[model samples]
Target: MELSSLKFYNVIVLGFAFMLMFTGFQTCGMVEQTVLKSYRNDSIVNGTVTYNGDGYTSLAIIYVVFAFANWLAPSVVSVLGNKFSMVAGGITYTLYLSSFIKPITATLYIGSVLIGFGAADKQRIPLYIGLTSVCALGTALLLILRSHPIQKLEVGDPEEDQPSEEEEETSDEAAMLNDSLDVTHRLSWKLFLTRDMMILSITFFYTGLELTFFSGVYSTCVGATERFGEDSDKLVGLTGIMIGVGEILGGALFGIFGKKTIRYGRDPIVLMGGAIHMVTFLLIFLNIPDLAPLNKTPDSAYITPNTYLAVACGFLLGFADACFNTQCYSIIGTSYPDNSAPAFALFKFEQSLAAAIGFAYSSHLVLKWQLLILVIFAVAGVVAFFVVERKVRSRAEPSGSSYRNI
Candidate 1:
């Protein structure tokens, strides 16, 4: 196969690897609030204490640690190399899943911490129980699959200032043998403080905020609405499926049309995502009760609880999420192609921090208030993204000829 074909093939394989792992982890995460809240407070199982309503706090802890861990991740990955890094990350996830069997506060919290280090997401319990096997298979696949080959950049002379293939392999081996902590820290922080990065951080934070809302808060609210009747828990899972379907469709649409969209830049897509999210928020504000996030509510704010509408909102939420996330990946990949790892680390740090904050407030705030916050961030984020996009484009254009051409 051609090198370009191999490169594309590697990208596809990597994406599927992540999907296999996240499918199980996130499916379980979707219903964590409902399941954990059901545990009787002060109850003992196998002589371990059970605390009710700890799910929000647990999710919060994961993102909190994940935020901090992002800084160290580059160093760790550099030291371990791509293959071993995957192995180590997979192990952390496995350990986290193992903790679920015993169901103790210590195990749960500790598991959260471990998985946070590994960068994990979660779901509903019986589903998690079944999905654990799927996650394990994904982990094993990482071990079985070959590491992706790095494609050299085309800019400048291919031979000039570039190491030979053997030298590159040797350098990679040396990096794995040496500590990269100091270099990783310096590059990550330096890039993070740049004007472009600082502005883009707003969009990153907004992405995380909406992620928490759709993944955890919204699912919980859906389950808590008494108007959904006794099968509300089931509805949460159904909502998750709808969200997944939307995400898949959105991803497919963009992925296929990406070549055509490349000339337009990301601002339009970001604005469209922001608009979709605003609409979703509006639907939530009208259809879901104010107190839905906190507990079961008998009625919605204005409209009667329509299960179809609720699931439809989930679909919209997921579709918008795809737009933002794909743009984020594109932006980071293009803007800092030479320093992509650090750029990604910085993005993850900001995004996870916002997710942590959102989870922290999820249990306290009403659904309407949460929706309001999302709206504010959505507007701010879209505007910030547009500004940065223009700045980047201007920098790419020939400064003197820009006016002459126009």
Candidate 2:
């Protein structure tokens, strides 16, 4: 009955609901490139090409549209309010999943666009129907969630000053309008020109770039390597599962030790994540054939493709990715608590744009070149993050206190 307890319960329920939905959604994303690519290759071989699309193209479209959707999400959320906005968003997923049943290229592309909307945030029974059913359940749960509690001032409390109901309603409406205007202003050129935003954008962009790789491209490379044997297709799913495991582990650790980690600040965690990613990239370069990114390849890299290595890399990639994301969320929230909507919108915009570009080139670039690009961005991103963090800390320091290096 207590507000805090009710809030915690809501969060827990929401977490579980999302877990169920994303379990299906993320699994599909992980395997989509491989599955679609295989279908295309097979069709070509058989001369029966009904669908001419590949997963890379589909993912590229999703992220590019997702980038644009970020600009519209705030207005959509403001108009619909948070809860209904989520339900509306959830329905998009169901529609996306439904498109998979017959798998027409047009439908798939349309579904990709719809899902991109959902994701900036669908299904089929056929095997996809099961995924759709799971997601629908999650949406159902969202529909039932209690809206967040509104706190009322108690008489005799220091902040107990209260206004008449009509006055309060007018004030609240004014505040809402002002907040919306503030978000819009911040999302404009002013925020983009800030030194902090510019620097942080690099890290944000890299996160998206790296995100596309592990979530989509890496699995495709794994599936395409013939050296891994006919079971390479199976390995794609397994690699995805391992990545999910690592992500869960990292999330659990960060959630548990979050307060403690704050003592040392976010940069250390980000640096550690970047280091892990660099190592993972090195291993991929050594372990996967260069041609793996373009198509199914009959060759091996310097090291023969070992199932264990692929799985381990996936785990490391996922774990490191969690580190970057969690830290980025913290940094943005702390830096722009007053204007978090625009800040987050900018973050998603940059991230999605980078992801779109990465996926666009996924089919064209070799594994080595992709790895090199990741490394270059990783280094630049880390440096930029450090610079912005220092500036933020400097600003946060008390007027008379010595600035302690993080």
The reply for model 1, stretches above 4 Å from the true place, is 1-16, 41-50, 78-81, 117-125, 147-181, 399-406
The lDDT for every candidate, in the order shown, is: 0.78, 0.80
List where candidate 2 sits over 4 angstroms from the true fold. 42-48, 117-126, 148-183, 397-406
Task: Please give, for residues 364-395, the per-residue lDDT of candidate 1 as tens digits.
Answer: 99888899899999999999899888876786
Q: Worst ten-residue run, lDDT, model 1?
A: 117-126
Superposed Cα RMSD, model 2:
4.8
Task: Please estimate how well model 2 matches the true structure, expressed as its whole-model Cα lDDT.
Answer: 0.80
User: TM-score for every candidate vs. truth?
Assistant: 0.83, 0.87
Q: How much does each candidate deviate from the true structure in C-alpha RMSD?
A: 6.1, 4.8
Per-residue lDDT tens digits for candidate 2, residues 151-232, read: 6666678965456865878568756876876657566557778889998999999999998999898998898899998688
Q: Which TM-score value belongs to model 1?
A: 0.83
| Most lDDT-accurate candidate | 2
**Cα distance off (Å), candidate 1, residue 357:** 1.1
